[model samples]
Target: MRKKRRYIIVMATCILCFFGIIYFIVPKILFYTQMYDNRINVAIKNATDIHDLLEEAIHCIEKRQYYSAIKLYQKVVQDYPYHKKTEGAQHAIGSCYEWAGNYKKAKEAYNIFMKKYPDSKLAEICRQHVVELDNPIYRKVNDAMVDKPEQLDKIIKKCQKIVNNSSGQKKTDAMLKMGECYFLKKEYLMAIEIYQEIISNYPDYSRIREVEQMIGVCQGLLGNYGKR
Candidate 1:
């Protein structure tokens, strides 16, 4: 009877140990799962907060307070790295860099945005800015307006290089700018040739009509004296 009692005691001890292990492990597993769910819910709740920050940044930009807008965007990018608003934050960084007169940094930031979010609408705007930065006449005009007309020849040469290296819309824009540079210098014939090339090669560009009109003006200036 003592042996029987000892055996029953051992069995009860084993049962308790089994229940103790389950009790400890089950609660741990449930706690972690609950914590994960809570994290997700918090992220969802804060999603709109990110959007509100972006809207406020836009308002700051419209008011010409670029530095303030940049500060807010930087916060959005850093604080919500995993949020859907990150792409817009990156694009805003690029725009802010441009406004801050850091064109090289702006271009780098834009390149990052393009690589990370190629299908984003903001990527298209960044691409356009990249093209504008590459344009010789645009840079020259900007420099001339800013009291740096000495950079004009350098800008023109850069445009020529761009024309030689690129094709399609980019090359067409380069060619058009090269023509404009020559026109600015009163080199009428060179300008006419470049403008005519645009008419022939980039006829689908939106600026084709403008190029055609410029070509006519160049011809008249070059003494072609034809109506047309």
Candidate 2:
């Protein structure tokens, strides 16, 4: 009877140990497994969003709806700041400015892209664009100078002067240019503020449509899509 009782006690202890392993170890294993899966799902979703936004921007470009394209590309940058697709979106923004006949703005965009992605494959191409736009021949037509990384403050100063002195449509345009300068500098919050100012103060401005779109772009770039 004594031996039997000892045997029974040992079996009970073994059963409790087995349940303790289940109560602790199994849940931990499952929890980590789920957490890893969650991370993978998040990664997949990010990749999908980036891909879709980039494709939409390209579609807009093909249709020549530049404003639309720019807004979409801006979202790509803001949504996934360092994503693989971000570099291409940034490149497209510069190209769009050039195509829109905004040469000075083009130079800002191109120069900034080069600076931000100094090691990128697109860096050399962006540099060529800056050189071409800053060429005397091109300058004669557009009066545009490529604002180097070192000259961003100067560019902002010039735009600010225009804002301080200009009137009517010119003033509104200058304000927009100032905002663009900020955007190129990646001072996105400042850019958004300027764009919003244009919308509020220049309601009758002919390019209100463009200004509104710019605000949307800046907001998107600032990760303020909820407001957009």
Candidate 3:
């Protein structure tokens, strides 16, 4: 009788442990397995139009999920090719690749975009991107100069020269680079001035939104400095 009681107790405990593992560990395994796949499918299914798809792709970009963002943008290009915003979605794919450090893919995407939408307002922007991606000075500012603040003054001089010699698209990009250099040097006022120059000189620049946001950030930094 005693041996039978002990055996029954052991069996019950083993069963409970097995159920606990299934309840906790198994769900975790399944959740991780389906994480990206399930969310992406749901996001696509819930999208009713190209705008919805574009919004979701932007959200994915904010989350740093560039691959998923690309998928969403591709869906827009494939499913709603004639939509007005389709060109924007296509351009966004290149932007995502650029942000993700895949400059080669970004250049390819931008080239394809320019070919497909030759008269687009963004075409000049894409041409500028292609030029910069191929430029050693631009590459240095983007890839290494920001990390090495000691070289920022040198970069600023180079960008100022570009701004002086170039016009339209190239000038706008060089001004943006100079703003970044000033911002890195903690010269918030100078950064804001450079950004404002872009706004005044190139109202239709594709990155106007980004420039505005940088100005806002610079103001906030100035306010913090005042407090300190």
Best by lDDT: 3
Q: Which lDDT tens digits does candidate 1 get at residues 54-94?
A: 65565554444556667677778877888875775787687
Winner on lDDT between 1 and 3 is 3
Residue pairs clashing, model 1? none
Q: Per-residue lDDT of 10-125 in model 3, one digit per residue for the tens?
A: 99999999999999999998897589867888989988877677666755754557778898989999999998768877887887776566789999999999999998777777
Between the candidate structures 1 and 3, which one is better when assessed by TM-score?
3
RMSD of 3: 12.2
What is candidate 2's CA lDDT for residue 25? 99
Ordered from best to worst TM-score, the candidate numbers read: 3, 2, 1
Residue 55, candidate 1: how far off, in angstroms? 3.4
Write down the RMSD of candidate 2 (Cα, Å).
18.4
lDDT of each: 0.68, 0.68, 0.78
Error of 2 at 193 (Å): 1.0
Name the TM-score of candidate 3.
Answer: 0.57
Query: Model 2: per-residue lDDT, tens digit, 1-228?
Result: 999999999999999999999999999999976775464444445656776675555545444456566667777778888887587678778768775667777788878888889987667767767887777764442323233444656766877888898788778766776776666666778888888888788877665645565565556555554254
Consecutive 10-residue window with the lowest summed lDDT within model 3: 219-228
